[model samples]
Target: MSEIPPFEIIRASRRSISIQISKTYGLVVRAPFSVPEDIIHAFVDRKSDWIMKHLARHTEQRERKNNTLYYLGHIYPFEYNLLQKETVTHSGGMFTFSGKVKDSGMEQAALTRWYRKQAQIYLSERVYHFSWKHELKHRKIRITSAVTRWGSCNGHNDLNFPWRLLMAPKEIIDYVVVHELSHTVHKNHSKYFWNLVESIIPDWKAHRRYLKEEGWRYALPKF
Candidate 1:
């Protein structure tokens, strides 16, 4: 016998349904356009276990996100290759890679510096292109090695992107840049915000999925 569930339900004008049970925030339900309230409540009750598991996982993730980067001997990728390598550059900005180091502090510093520079170059150029195209005036874009967030937008419209984004493909990077810019118009991830995103980048769903699933592959290790 299931007692009448007491949970706040949110119905969106989209084609998906979800139930969120936050530890501190409590239970919240989201349903597709015009879903009946009774049906939504039934759905939440049907998947109570799953909702609890996800909420637990989300709590764990939030806790982990609060930690800081150690930046020890963790390996970081330069290009698409997963394996860490000894990277070097020629006269031009052209880069080359070999393999990882054993215990050379000098080599590690050199590689880290190179990665930071590369991140700056790649992120700035891409941010500039999208910012201009969307007419989303922003203060400045800089790449930092933040522990958690991929990117952020400040009150002044200053956009900050994680340097790790450079490790992914250009399309993924574009999605991040566009995501921050979209925030300038709508600060939250409301339906209108998503609509604004789809208007600019029609294939945004694929990119969003890629970032959520595979984007972590591009993240540098503790180093």
Candidate 2:
């Protein structure tokens, strides 16, 4: 708390200066247009303890996120290896990437390709299992890289799901499958949709809440 950490300043038409912490950007200072540079520096110095506390928190979260990978709703330690032969492998309670990727772009592309293939194989089987159990019919199963959507059923009856769903637990995945499959029967999220979803997954709301709260953690790492 003795010295202020590095931060970027953005002066705007405002009355006060505020500090914001980011894992990627470190710290940011938003100040009023009339606030002098020295005044902003003094204010940041005065709040050094608080700023340092948040920075420490961000650091811990960043490290934890970097070290862990979510698969089938479980957190597994992850590693990258440039000298190994296999592209990727899940063994000994770890998910390791052994691709000879030279950069992060190549690394991301390789990992995402693996994630998409896993999604296609796993989700297709689950969708079919549920559809067959309930006597539902679907045209096709598509694994997508959708950011904002988890699963959707269109007029063509093709069930679309994001590869990210593979990061959630199996029950949660099943809930999404039932939810979208129900959409095949009920186009809108009306009373009938909820009723049907409840009929299939009695705790569908809990799973949905889990996704709304923690689903953001399920994504490619930023290193």
Candidate 3:
């Protein structure tokens, strides 16, 4: 057998193996415990075309979304028809929330805690419903402050969601839930995986637009 290009492989206890080519990260292979390097490379070489296509498409989509940003003072939807009210009041310091609470400047520490609590209640229920409907299995759910990602899933099937998601609309929050759950089935952004996502949330495009535009602001908050 020929020596394949250098790439990363994630080995775990599973039935079938899969390979992926990323836009920014390049090729990756997730295999079961018994699959050998030579065999995995052979599989990757066999499906290189499919990998390239998925990677290109993923990159294109990411590039398109990158242009959007959520600057302060911009309006974003909240539960029901309540818009997130952005107010810079004079008190002590930090951010604060009133009606919808786009960004309430009271204190970063207090605001972060409040955001986490909100995310816990909101994200968990959505995760429960979607997971049940799709019959997807996962371990636990958690909230954190991630720099770039909105949500992520570990190999243990634990889901981590950014508390900042509370700044966005309920529908956008649901989109993140569905997107993360989709990872449980397909770990990469392949064609089949996106197809599965579309089947679940048909209007994912709008949600994604909300994220790219409104989500950018949350990511850049002082807290």
lDDT of 3 by residue, 161-200 (tens): 9887776667777888888898888899898878888999
Candidate 3 local accuracy as lDDT? 0.69
lDDT for 84 (candidate 1): 75
Worst 10 residues of 2 by lDDT: 99-108
The order of the candidates by TM-score, greatest first, is 2, 1, 3
Across 1-223, the per-residue lDDT of candidate 2 in tens digits comes to 3766677999899888989987668899999988889999999998988887677766756776656778999889888887746576778999887765456676677778888999999999998898999877888899898999899999999999998899889999999999999998999999988999898899998999998867777887674
Q: Model 2 off-target regions past 4 Å? A: 1-11, 15-21, 24-61, 84-86
Taken over the whole model, the C-alpha lDDT of each candidate is: 0.66, 0.85, 0.69
What's the CA error at residue 178 for candidate 3, in Å? 0.4
lDDT of 1 by residue, 1-223 (tens): 4442477777688786786666666678788877887787777778877666566555544543412221111222232222475554422333333345443454445556666787778777877888788888788777777747778988888888876676667777777888888888888899998998888888889988877765545543322
Mark the regions of model 3 whose C-alpha exceeds 4 Å error after superposition. 1-106, 219-223
True-vs-predicted CA distance for residue 167, candidate 3, Å: 0.8
**Best model per TM-score:** 2
The candidate with the higher lDDT, 1 or 2, is: 2
TM-score of 1: 0.54
Task: Single out the weakest 10-residue window by summed lDDT for candidate 1.
Answer: 66-75
